[model samples]
Target: MSSGSALIPLDRALARLLDGLGPVAAETAALPDAAGLVAAETLHAPRALPVRPLALRRGIAVASADLVGATPHAPALLPSAPPVVLGGDVLPEGADAVLPADAAATSGPFHEIGQSAYPGEGAVLPGTDLTDGAVIVAAGAPITAEAVLALQLAGIAELTVRRPRIALMGDAAGAEAAWLKARLARAGCAVTDAAPADLVLHLARDPAAVVAGPGLALQPGGDAALLVDGTSRTLVLAPRADALVAALFALVFPVVAVLQGRRLATVARALTRNMASQVGLADLALLRHTPEGWEPLGVGRVTLMAILAADAVAILGPESEGAAAGAPIAAIPLQEPFDPR
Candidate 1:
């Protein structure tokens, strides 16, 4: 449905929302509190652990050359050897490998060498434990449990992470605003009800009324829009029964993804029925799984009751008119379609 000439294409609106939008301010969070937060800076390994090769078994350290050609049939006698134990010793001076205990024997002052010491045999080499300057976490990547453990082993006590602040203002308690708020929170945004926010979500009961002061192509009685509030980016939602969800996904979600420096991911599925859309406007579709394939529950204006039964959602770009039945379309999952026990 055409709102008016004032309505910008979803892609252009997203570009305007993302133009020069860097990450929000960075804060130092202790390692324990870092998981689920976005890394503001890349962290590198502080040092190489076990700087030298360490023994992998109970053994004697010796120059590999000293054991060359030595075998049980032709034993090479050494004056003495430095003792190395598993988890307790490094390769001794002048030693390049570990000769396992069974490979050598004590004979008075000479240590009998009965096996050739293959290079790197019976021992782990330097950096086998950790390498210096290796990337632990890249900037814009989420801090995960595995990442946290790596950082701990790398001696990182804390990390620099970015948490975008969002001001979620709803005209009243409604399912649409609640859904949007929960989605944003799950995306790692810190939600508030005050100023000083990196983003503002202004939800209005009137599908096309301005609760937040007007500017930036938005009409007092028009469609939902993205506008600026000083340095804060504001998203005004005209919560029309049919239009609310389309705005939430196409405009709001992408804006938040940019704030966190990420791209929205989608899964591909074959459509069960042909979909139709306005060529110049992005269309939102809600879908459900059926025996044949994925089927659209509703397109464009969808009832909340219809939305509840959906398994996935897809936002068709403005460049697309629609797709024929059985064609693959990218969709975003609201929940797992097939539960794996």
Candidate 2:
């Protein structure tokens, strides 16, 4: 039987994509917390992790050799020793390890004269827990709290990661108004609204704005993607920005019929499939202010319609369009644009 759409289950789709693409990383969040996030590269141990054995409990320090001579009947008297606190490093010279206060009779000195003590029987061995330059975690591994702790223990300073970024355009567009820029910045992304943006966001209050943004965004060939989301609607499409308006008119609808004074269907079948591995959309801004009035103009028409639809769209606009709406887009050729908003 033929299905209406070749739809793979969401879980199945994710699994396939993950398997093919491998682990994707976000920017390096601080260690001791950003566990589960993919490591940018291999991180080496700063010095030696757990450089020394931490005492498990409060106790007295004693040398394994010192206890060699003790016996049950004629027990050697142990010399008076200071109390060792938990986490204290046991010195290797005289004390092989520490004896828990509860386990030893500290009231009297322990003295052994004739017997021998076993090696490593009473103390922590150096480099047993972990050694220096050990690969604590690998690249593409998910960061977890435990991993964060391990990184901290390993003494990692700065971590390299794929930082999230968003480019903005729309009816009410402004470089400062880019929510993703602000959000990512707050979340520790060195953000920029420049072209070749990691992502693009078509943030307008209406569908019309979305259309305009897509028209503008789909210019740099069909390689970069577009995402439009707001008010229970999200459209992932790719439109050829480089394609002339006349070419689109020829492809989607018959301009000749319209010229002949026939009002054809307003909706055109001009959609480009999403070639993105990951697509995310969010209405972080629940706007309610009704626009007084706006006449559709140039690319702004899409933004205006969105205002009428009471919905918004975010598109991964062209990398060049970083200036305020009216201003010119940048000159750089945008690549790998992102729209994680």
What TM-score would each prediction reach against the true structure? 0.63, 0.42
Residue-wise C-alpha lDDT for candidate 2, range 1-341, written one tens digit per residue: 12212232222322322232222244556665454333556666766645654554456555666666565555445556535655546554555556655445534344333333444444555666567777765553334466567677666755755433333344324433443334334332344545344334334434344454322123211222233232111222223222212112211112112211222232111112211211221001101112321111223122323334422222222222222322211111011111111
- Assess each prediction's global lDDT (C-alpha) against the native: 0.70, 0.36
**Candidate 2 lDDT score at position 141:** 39
Count of steric clashes across candidates, in order = 1, 37
lDDT by residue (1-341, candidate 1, tens digit) is: 35434466666767777777876778889987888777878899898865777777777777778878998888899876556566447787667677666777888888788888876677777776778898888887777788899899778999887778888776736766677677666666787887678878777754345633322221221367567645767777755545556665666666666676665667788999998865555677888877777798876657778788987878776567788999998887764211111
Candidate 1 segments whose C-alpha is farther than 4 A from its true place: 1-9, 12-16, 46-50, 56-65, 76-84, 87-101, 128-133, 156-159, 168-188, 192-194, 202-228, 236-249, 261-275, 278-281, 285-314, 325-341
Q: Kindly report which residue pairs in candidate 1 clash with one another.
A: 207-238
Query: lDDT of model 1 at residue 262?
Result: 61
What TM-score does candidate 1 reach?
Answer: 0.63
In terms of lDDT, model 2 sits at 0.36
Candidate 2: C-alpha RMSD after superposition: 18.2
